[model samples]
Target: MDLRRIKDWTLLPGASIEVRQQGRGVWSGLVDAVTADGEILWVIDPSGQRRLFEKAEFYEAWAIEERDGFHYEVTKNDDNLQKVS
Candidate 1:
C-alpha cells in the first residue's frame, strides 16, 4: 500500500506502526498521537515513553510481508509517501 492509502485510514491509538528513523534504525510501536501536519508521536518499547517525529523523515514503509506461510522480507520505499493528511 502507498502512503496516501495508509494515511487515508485513520491511524489512532493502539495501532502498531513500524517507524524507520534517520540513522536510528527501525522500531515498532503504538501510535500515541498524530498531528494535523502529519507528524507522528509514538513510544519505543523498552525505552519508556513516546517521542515526536515527522512523517517526512521516514525513508520507506516498513511492514512484514509473508508468502506461503513464510516470512518474505521487510519492504521500504519512497513511493508510498504523500503530502496531504
Candidate 2:
C-alpha cells in the first residue's frame, strides 16, 4: 500500500479493514485512530479488541465500498509499501 495511495483511507476513524498475517487467519476491523506521523494504525475489531499495527504489517486493506469481490496485496520493499491488486 503506497503511503500516498492509502493514507486518506487509513486516516478515516471509521474506515473498515481486512488484514491477513502470514500463516494466520484474516482479521477484520474498523480504524480507531492513526498516529500523527501516519506510521501506525489503531484498530478495533468486531469483538471490541484494540490492536496497534505498523503500517507495514498490513498486507491487505480496502474501504468497504471497494470490497466488492476485489482483492489487494500489500508488501513492503525498500521501506515502501506496495499495493498490488
Candidate 3:
C-alpha cells in the first residue's frame, strides 16, 4: 500500500506479492528471498519456480489465494478489490 509497508513486507520470507509485467499483466508468487541490492526473489510454488524482480519492476502488494496452493492476485483500491487491511 505504501513504500515502507512494501519494503517491510517484501522483507518477509514466504510473503506473496503481485508482479506486473510489461505485456503479461500481473503475476502472483511467494517471496523466496531479497537480494542485497533490494531485488526480490519470488517463487510460484505450484510451478515450482523462482524469479527475481527489482523494485522498478514492481507494481503493488497482492491478495493471496490459499487453497491447494498459494496464488497471487493484484489489488486495486479504486476497483474495491480485497486487501489485507
Candidate 4:
C-alpha cells in the first residue's frame, strides 16, 4: 500500500482511514461524521468508541484503498487532521 499526500478532499462516513500527526501514527478507524463546515471529525473504532478531533495544520489523513484489478484514486482532502493533542 502506498500513501499519498492529499491536498483536496472530504471525509465521508463509513470510510476507513489512518490518521497521522507530526510523522507519527495516531488513530485508524471508520469515519463517523465530519461537520458540515469541515472543521471537525468523528470516528468510531473497533470497540465502538467514538472520538472527535478538531482540524489542525499538522494532521494528515490518508484514505486506505484496495485496488489492482480494482484500483482507485484516493480522493484527497486539503483540510488538515483533527485535534487530539
Against the true structure, candidate 4 reaches a TM-score of: 0.62
Best-to-worst order by lDDT is: 2, 4, 3, 1
Identify the superior model by TM-score, candidate 1 or candidate 2.
Answer: 2
Clashing pairs in 1: none
Q: Highest TM-score: give the candidate number.
A: 4
lDDT of 1 by residue, 1-85 (tens): 3221133212444455555556344665565666554455554554656766566666322322211322233344455433222
lDDT of 4 at 17: 61
lDDT score, candidate 2: 0.59
Number of backbone-clashing residue pairs for each candidate, in the order shown: 0, 1, 0, 5
Which 10 consecutive positions of candidate 1 have the poorest summed lDDT? 63-72
Q: Which residue pairs overlap in candidate 2's backbone?
A: 1-82
Clashing pairs in 3: none
Span of ten consecutive residues with least summed lDDT in model 2: 1-10
Q: What lDDT does each candidate get?
A: 0.44, 0.59, 0.50, 0.58
What TM-score does each of the candidates earn? Answer: 0.43, 0.52, 0.48, 0.62
What are the candidates' C-alpha RMSDs? 8.6, 7.8, 7.3, 8.3
lDDT by residue for model 3 (9-53), tens = 334466655655552435566777766555555556457676656
